[model samples]
Target: MESLQALQDFIKTKDNFRNFVNSSEVPSVCKTEPCMLGVDEAGRGPVLGPMVYGVAYCPLSQTSVLKDLGCADSKALTEEKRDDIFRKMLTEEASLNNVGWAAEIISPNYISNSMYRRAKHSLNEVSMNSAIDLIKKVAESGANITEVYVDTVGPPEKYQAKLSEIYPNYKITVAKKADSIYPIVSAASIVAKVTRDHALKVWQFKEGLEMTHAEFGSGYPGDPLTKKFIREQVDYVFGYPMLVRFSWSTAELMLQDKAATCTFEEIDDELPKKKVKSISSFFSVKSEDGAMKRKRHKFFEERYLSMDNAFE
Candidate 1:
């Protein structure tokens, strides 16, 4: 029995070791060719927060190291785990450089349109521009970048066109799930999410908003709490705070409601005498058959009757 138990323990340990080895093995998806950059964005849907765009670059030689770092899609990881991995990539990994573009206080009205539209107009543009800028800087410093992959916000073709216009020298590929397919984009996503989350926390505290049980996770328009807060702020006439985006539909709704409540009156230099036409004379008209047809309209009478009743 003791010998059997020892054998079982040895097998279990060996199996565990094998599992670790498999987990640590670099993913085979990364191209062996040198020079690829990954790009992604976050906070595109948030009603209260800024849109964040991120970009990360990795040389071909370090692709295996990044894969071994367990880099995957940021959406697959918890906030804590993402932060941990992001920090590890930044410090321990030599090939990755992550950068972010944040647009603060984007209006709720903008969110009513498609998120992809907003991302394309704002975050995507900023991120791509910044990424190109970084690539140019790196190239000037003698670093060669052969290719870039962006997790497309809008159609893949649109991103491809934009990147082509921006960076004519390098090859750019825009795909729907580049974050999952490319480790560099995943790394950028991790950094972007972490940065945005931190910014949201700081904004919450600064705005005197309670974060506890707030359910304001990311503050997207879909969040009930965000909608409620928007309605309350607008209804309370908080004077369009800087934290709130004036371009959002929430703000427009509030403005419309305010407009509707205002009373309007006209001023005149002189009062005109009321003209009254006899109902019988007004209704008397000749028909096609030459017989007088009397048509009595009750709408005016009913309105006058209601006014009389109110006065009484």
Candidate 2:
């Protein structure tokens, strides 16, 4: 009885402990240099829906506004909280630009490769273009842009290379976790996530697919609901919908498993013959000096099929 009473007393002191922790004094906003644009992206790992990327420009004058808004990583917030923040950002802030890359449905065999290559390419292209556009607009309005910071997707150097390829005139810095360090990047994260969620909702409505409250998460592989959605769609007899990235390895594996379960002799016969490809003959490779070399490497490279080409 004494131990139970002590536990109750400890529980009663929780609010006081919280108040003590919260009372620690700290500066509201960290000082940062002016005129740097922060860029970040969202929706890269989702098995379904389009990848959304965003860029936000903070001109250093509004640092306190960001701090007051509680600008931090979007992943750290609940969906409702993110939506609230997103709304506040759009209404109150005028220096933000959000862009998205929508990958339409292709056949399942190509989803993983297509997403990794083409989807990423598309997202990067869009992000760069949007950043350039926003910077140009800001400059025309008499705002100076000294540097641009981006949350690195692949590598820091690669971003510089790609940005140079896209926009040779501007200077850019690409670093991993820029979103966590920079308020502008955090704002971009919010825009990208909110935009993606809206797009997903629209897609779900258009496809006539019904989902429970927990069905759509951040679309990461870690989400059980996402995995379940993928499994259900893969096993569906009518074929996958137009929203699915069919090139994913998971989709291909599911399709191969389904094909294996079939009892059709015609399919079985076609399978083995199809598997045996005379690679040298197909590529017209010359077997010289005990080495096979193709005249054109492009012929052996995987072709990226678009959504329209996938069905055909």
Per-prediction TM-score to the true structure, in the order listed: 0.57, 0.57
C-alpha root-mean-square deviation, candidate 2: 17.7
How far in Å is the alpha carbon of 111 misplaced in model 2? 7.8
**Mind giving the per-residue lDDT tens digits that candidate 2 earns over 1-312?**
112233224323432111110010111221133455666666666666555555555555655666666768888888787776665544323223221111111212233344477436444454455455544544454444566777876677977787766656557777889888877778767766765565555343234567743565545666787777667765445445545555555555776766344555666656555456676577575677877765544534457544467678
Candidate 1 per-residue C-alpha lDDT over 118-235 given as tens digits, one digit per residue, 9 for 90 to 100:
3545544544555555445544444456778878876899879977887898889889988998887787676567655654554433345555324554577777887776666553
- lDDT of candidate 1 at residue 265, scale 0 to 100: 65
Question: Which is the leading candidate under lDDT?
Answer: 1
Q: Candidate 2: where is the Cα deviation over 4 Å? A: 1-34, 92-144, 164-169, 205-207, 235-238, 259-312
lDDT of 2 at 142: 45
lDDT per model, in order? 0.55, 0.53
Worst 10 residues of 1 by lDDT: 16-25
Question: In the order shown, what is each candidate's alpha-carbon RMSD?
Answer: 21.0, 17.7
